[model samples]
Target chain A: MVLYLIGLGLADEQDITLKGLRAVQSCSKVYLESYTSILLVDDFKARMEALYGQPVTLAHRETVELEADEILRGAHEGNVAFLVVGDPLSATTHSDLILRARHYQAPGAEAPTPVPVKIIHNASITTALGSSGLAGYNFGQTVSIPFWTDDWRPDSWLARIGENMGLGLHTLCLSDIKVREQSIEDMSRGVLRYQPPRYMLLPQLISQLLAAAREHQVDFLDPERTLAVALCRMGAEESATRRGELVRAGTLAEMLACTEPDEAQRRQDEQDDEAFEEANPTVSEKEMDARREARRVQRAIDFWGEPLHSLV
Target chain B: MVLYLIGLGLADEQDITLKGLRAVQSCSKVYLESYTSILLVDDFKARMEALYGQPVTLAHRETVELEADEILRGAHEGNVAFLVVGDPLSATTHSDLILRARHYQAPGAEAPTPVPVKIIHNASITTALGSSGLAGYNFGQTVSIPFWTDDWRPDSWLARIGENMGLGLHTLCLSDIKVREQSIEDMSRGVLRYQPPRYMLLPQLISQLLAAAREHQVDFLDPERTLAVALCRMGAEESATRRGELVRAGTLAEMLACTEPDEAQRRQDEQDDEAFEEANPTVSEKEMDARREARRVQRAIDFWGEPLHSLV
Candidate 1:
């Protein structure tokens, strides 16, 4: 039985290639690596299930990292396929799986074992970033922007971006994604509580970048003079402005600022436990207005007439 | 009617996605952008034709650059698909086509008009280079090595690699390809004679690199110490190597040196403009022996190999 590692490209399930879909359809077991990146679309699981005509077991971080033996055992029984976003093996975990699958032996056997493994390549954000009309070759090392905690904030990635800038090359920044994480207290309480999934928004990223620039004395970036393109849901139906003026940075900052609790809300925090109504994850009026105003400005710059994309 | 810019991925026709194939099947015109890169498989046109179930026209630089108006004109009639190897818009010409296709109008039009354009992203070398187990973000600006001319030899790309090395990053050096090139004399004579297609081999690349290191005083690339990976035919069925040692530099130089004219051959060249056997492109015995020895060494080093490929 062959072990197939397939890439489902960017966007929805339809992004899977004819070659990849064939592999998936023929597999006895299909798994989707879901913790790294997101399709950012509704009904993603249902849509994928409908297209594959098979139930896909969504593999979270712990499952992917710790349950390889079980996955390989399934492959031992019949052909098993793992679906990854972007290219099949960009993540080291996937590559390690491929390498491990090659040497996997039956549970109680001692003889050497080999199951043929194949990989299907697809468009990754590394390549999809080309849609921004920037030369791929000009990009230096990419960086990630994680949500900052109160005490620890690292600016190491910014240094690399500055180095790339020094050489007149572009940087393809990968936004940080947090899926199935737990708050420190939640983890210690043994309650199995999970934090809400979070994807770093562009505004938060820009704010962190601005802070890094100021702290690191990275002269390349000045809020008023520096130009940067904040991309989200690239190559999808709805894409952000291909090019941008730094003015959007102001709007984005305001929008993010508006997401913060007001003085009244902060004062009320000590009075009661969170209520269902207060816990609703909806934007405030001012934040909504800020977002609308930002998009309103972006609408003027989207010359490509791409499909509508919400800048989340 | 929409103008679709589809990426054919790497390798052969089978690499085309289901989405791309459906788009091409629905198109009235399909043009393969052949000048930028190659599928590298034999009988590529026939293979693509058999797969697409429609005629595919191979587009050269002259046709793509000079007769773009004619292509956009076809988009006016019905859906037209322009097929590109790797991602569609990585090359400026292809991107220009997308932008131009947007503004194209019917033949005797007066005011500005808009034509729909959709880009289908696929795996390009920029992303496929990840097969080497190197981080995509760690890659600095990529550079292409062109066939050298006697009067001009540019080492600008080497400097970029040096800068990347300074930042502890990797460099993806793309080898140059020459398809349907013309000699200077042929151009002046207005003759349509074409030169044979040339794909740069590793030996040639190393020769140039060594020269560049010395001439440009590149301190980073020490022939004895600096290691590099030689990759070829990425994302293909018969990928040469997931990665190969640049340590083959010594063997390649030796093998290339063995191909030089011997004393007898050099002496005979003075007496005749050309000889029947002298015009042969076959390798000399010494060159063959050196090649075998190199292969022997490579056999020990090629851990992730499927097939033998020229280094350049």
Candidate 2:
């Protein structure tokens, strides 16, 4: 009997490695830890069950943290599989699980007996960011930005980013995800009400980042020239990468908006541009430069479809 | 027609994702890029060929660098798969390949028409280091430690490590691999003769790091207390990690030597310790403390079997 911590890669169920799939098939009980990050495909559980020929229980944060003993007991009795969205070891919580598995005591056992634990590695978003045409080796520490509430705003990640930037290194900022959270009023009244899931998009991340930048009074490159690479749904067919400046205040939304155009609008713009170019064959170099810039922006917005709609 | 740059994950053929396997099965040609790192399996090409049912070609440095046009042409005619050991984009050379593929032109084409390139990501050694029980998010910029030949020792990586240490971040040092290299004499004689392939092991890396630390005159924690975690054959069945101190000069070898134990020897040692403890039933607290320390060291030496033997 063993506890297998398997990584389900960055995208859909197809991203699971053959080794991981084999392990899942061998396991009697399988769990997909679902609160950290969302998978990119629909009917994920059904698809995974179909592929692995095994039933999978969705383990929310509470299930993992509060009912870890139950999961460990399953491993104690038979082979168990714990599936994660990205690399299994990418999160501290999973590492803690491994540690707990090592020290778990059975109900009637006199002493602690370690469970045989095995990890199946897979692609993580931190390394998958290399798809953005940025050098992965140049990236410094990865920082996460939490969704800000009225009384809970933290800017420690800002200092880490600043340190990385000062060292001429890149910083990977992991977006926040809020899931299965109860409101303060509901918690005080001993209610079991939960709020809807909220995933922090690039717009919200940018707004918080810009606010921290201003409050810290750090001097950076010119607003128009300081570029950031925004990646959405990486390792999937709908993956998109955009390199654009981090403009401050209200214009930030406008800057993000113009670059993201629907496919029909983009096609129409290309046609209109070609027609104009044919009509004005002897256009000025300055105007041609502006057209090139516009095209560059348009090309950068390659596949910002439904996934990026919330950013607007 | 498309060029699929698929990652083969860290271990063997079984580490390839289902999507990657399907893509390879559909490809007309498959080439395994075999320079940056070595796959941790025997008969790698044969195993992959068996799994994919496609004839596999080993693409060495010369084949990829000097004959990329042929690969691009293969993609232009039909789908081709270029398999990499780790994540496809982890290395700059692969990024260059992607760029070249984008800008490649057919022999008689008037302009460079971009060919669609798809990257199927997998587990890279960088992210796989999370198995060492270190937080992946705490890692700083990754640096490379090249083989230090006489009269050509570079220490720029020292500064980068120092920067990371200043920020209290872990630095990942990628070991260098020298394959298909021509010696100075061979190059001077206009010969095609090549030198034997060389991999920078932990001992050599430690030697160079200590030299850099001394030359730079940087203050570090006590040598007995300062530790380094060395990982080998990650994401494989033989993967091993050892945490030991970075002592100076001669004793460094002794420190590394004492920790690595073969299974039989480890079992024998445990039996010997038990026998001694039983003989001396009322041992002093100081002797008991030493026994505890020995057990901790022995437990930490877990699974150092065949993989870490080279570290000595």
Candidate 3:
């Protein structure tokens, strides 16, 4: 049995290569490794279904980190493909998995430990960010900002960004996302409190950065002098937006106003669109008609003030 | 008049996006920026013809750095596009041009002053190297090697790589490329010592790396244990190879054995085969030709034998 690892790149479903598409088609079971990063567009499932005529099982962070053996259990019988957003091995977790696979190869194991593993490469955000005209080599340590807490807001990221700027290097700040997890309230009460997933928007990120900078006394980075880029709807069909420029309150406010609610709605609309597109045409007509009612909300979000978030 | 800055990714013609292609199509004059990097598969003329149905004017280092006004002159009359290998702004030199355009605007010139420059982004090798299971954040300072040198061959890149390893980070070593320039002999004696543009193979790079390590007295990295990935023909339609493994002389030798002379020729043959299939009336082509040609020369160089290079 062959273990095929494929990189789905940063953008929409089509960002995958012809080679990767073929591997997914022939695989007995395909698992989408749903951590490290999320694809801006949610039509990935529909696109994969359209191209390969197969349902893809999503392997979230828990499944990959904990239940990896279960994910690879049936690989000995036929082809098993694991799809990862961006390049397969960009994240340390995936690399650890590859090492585990190597260790699991036994003399008489059904899957014969030496399973042929092939990686199909695609575009990663690290390289894609170069569009801002920043030299790739001049980039310093990258940091992520988790959803802030009133008592536990960390300002360590400011130090890192300061260090990078000191060396004349640019800092790539990745926003955090909370997905498929219980709320803080639920965890404190020992009860299951399932909350909706949230993608951090540019406004919140900027505000946090500002707050952190102020608290850390990072006087060098003023909003007007320091250049920052916010990318929204990256690698999507309607992928429109901003480039690197000096950070301004007006720009951040504008980005927030457009992205805050619309992002969630866009995700829902994309999911419904994929489902509608995948269903039998005759039966899905009514559903498609019903889905059209949500287009107004989508349009409202699309026409919002500044296109700051769309900047690559 | 607008300055349309387009990124031609890493490899061949098809790597350019539909928007970039359109920008190139509408522009009367297009210049390919050549100093920053070299494309593996497509030349300026060939890519321009294939993507935009026009011939591209090649702007070498001197042409761009010295004769910038000539390239910008057309922007005042009509749309002008500067085609860069990666993203338009990835290099500081292009950004400097943009700043110059802003200066022109400040003078209140009647000309367009290249305002409202459009940037088209594409994948770069910086993040492409992350496919080796190396974390983007884990990479330290990146350095490049030049082709020609005097008696003193600089080995500072070795120190940088060692520092990265000390921090448990991977090093991205950009190999040297010498393209489209008259040699020293040509300038001094008026005899063109035009050598074929050379791309450092993986074996050569590894050899140098080993020698540098010995000189620096660093034994932290074991060629067999150190993970190295060699990527060749990135962002191209034809065979793009990404091989990851421990480095050794035998491995490097094997990789070199597979390198091909002409990638364009192979792609042309494949296209021809596809055209033949479409035109043929009788025979049913059941087999999908998915055989990826081997261009493993870079890999061979990466894994050169123990005591890789003798320090002269």
Candidate 4:
């Protein structure tokens, strides 16, 4: 019996390695960590179930963070699979799980019984960003930009980027993703309401970047001349790479204007959505809301399609 | 027609994604880029042939750098697969091939016919180093340590590492690899002779780091106290991670002494090699030489059991 932590490489279900697939098939229980990143393909859970010939339980933050002992218990009894988007250890939280498994002990047993753990590595954004044709050797530390709230805004990550820029090294910036998050008000009030998932779009990311540059008065990024590459839906069938300079406010829209869907196209997409709802009436409301949010983002950003967007 | 640059993820044949495998199976001709990195599995070609049901041609540095036109020609007429050990674009040379395919023109034709290039990403050393339990976000720019030679010993890469350390960030140091290399004297004499391939081991890497630190008079690295993690054969079944402090001269031997093979084990390995040679008398001289070199490397590196070794 072993605890197998497998990485589902970026893209869709098909991106899983044969080694990972075999491990999934042989497991008595399989868990998919779903909140960190989402696959580009639709019906991901259904498709994975069909392929693995077993039902997969989606492990949300609460499940993974609070109920890990149950997962280890399953592994202690029989082989269990924990699937993560990208490399299993890419996230620091998952590394904590590895440490937990090492020190796990059966609840009833007097002695400690650590469950054996194994990792099946797969492609992660840290490396898949190489599609930008940038030399990995020259990339400085990776930075992540979180979404700004009313009272909480941090610019330390920007300083990290500046440090890398000082050495003429490229920095990999990971955009923010808000999944199953509760609003501050809702949390404060002790309500059970949840907000719709939000994936950071390029326009918002660029806007924040420009705003940060102005506020921090950093020379690392030239508002009119700094070059950036926006990689969207990387490793997917319709993946796109766009290279652009960070220009003024007007230039931002102008650069993306050519690729923006026109009024007629937007109307057609809305009509198609209506037709889809009529055709598949059984679809859950949550799924419909997510799809509509994705469509709204598509109209806002010009060229990108699908999700799991990143920048370099 | 598409020129598919498929990534064979770290470890063995089964590490390739289902999508990559499908693309390889559909290709008209397949070429394995062999000089940049080598797969750990034995008879990699045979295993891939068995999985893909097709012959795979070995594309050495000469064939890929000089004879790329032929490969692009195959893709121009039909689908072709170019296999890379890690992520295809991880190496700059492969990125050059992508550019060539994009601008490729058909010979003896009136107009240019650029072939479509598609990349199937996979796990690379950049991200697979996550197995060390280090956060990818804290890693600074990657640096490569080249094997020093008489008259030209560059330590600029050391400076890059020092910069990373100054920022309280981790640095990924890629070890040097020499394949199908010809000595300067041999090249000057117009000789076709080549030197045996060499891969940088841990001792040599640490020795170079310490020597450069002393020569440059840098305070970034403390020879007696700087902590370092050595990641070897990452993503493989027997992948290992070792953490230790960078101690003085004699301590290096003391740290590695525990993992070193004993005299009896060395004798057993030599006897096993002799028995293998007797069993497979028809094996090529080049194959035997490569095996012997790999064995020598194993004895030099205490814990690493494969050729592709990296450090963080």
Pick by TM-score: which candidate is best? 4
Q: Order the candidates by lDDT, highest first — what do you get?
A: 4, 2, 1, 3
**DockQ-based class of model 1:** medium
Kindly indicate the candidate among 3 and 4 with the higher DockQ: 4
Please write out the lDDT profile of model 4 over residues A94-152, one tens digit for every residue.
98788899899898988889998888888888777777778888888888888886588
Candidate 3: tens digits of C-alpha lDDT, residues B1-312: 778877676555555654567778889888888767756552547855766777788888788778767666677667888988755665667876676555554244775454556665555666456545556666666767554255667887676666556655566677776677676777899885666665665556655676676777888645555556655544343334422222222333343343333578678867866776777655354432322212234334444311111110
User: What does TM-score give for chain A of every model?
Assistant: 0.77, 0.78, 0.73, 0.82
What lDDT tens digits, residue by residue, belong to model 1 across residues A1-312? 888888888776777777789889999999999887766457788988998999999988888779988888888889898999878766666777877887889878898576777777888777666676677767777776677877889888888878888888777766677888988998888878778876565555667788988888878866666656545565566425232211122343453443444688655643432342256557476665565545533433342122221221
Which ten residues in a row are the worst by lDDT in model 4 chain A? A242-251
Q: What TM-score against the true fold does each predicted structure earn? A: 0.80, 0.80, 0.63, 0.84
For candidate 4, state the interface root-mean-square deviation in angstroms to 1 decimal. Answer: 0.9
User: Across residues B49-140, which tens digit of lDDT does each residue of candidate 4 receive?
Assistant: 99999999999999988999999999999999999998888888898788899889998978789999888889888868787778988898
Name the regions of candidate 1 deviating beyond 4 angstroms.
Answer: A238-312, B238-312
Ranking 1 against 4 by DockQ, winner:
4
* Cα-lDDT of candidate 2: 0.77
Against the true structure, candidate 1 has what lDDT?
0.71
The local distance difference test score of each candidate is 0.71, 0.77, 0.62, 0.80
In candidate 2, what are the lDDT values of residues A15-56, reduced to their tens digit?
999999999998999999988876777678899889988788
- Which segments of candidate 4 are over 4 A away from where they belong? A239-298, B238-299
lDDT of 2 by residue, B61-122 (tens): 99999999999999998999999988998997888788899898989999996778998989
Model 4, native contacts kept = 0.83
Most lDDT-accurate candidate: 4
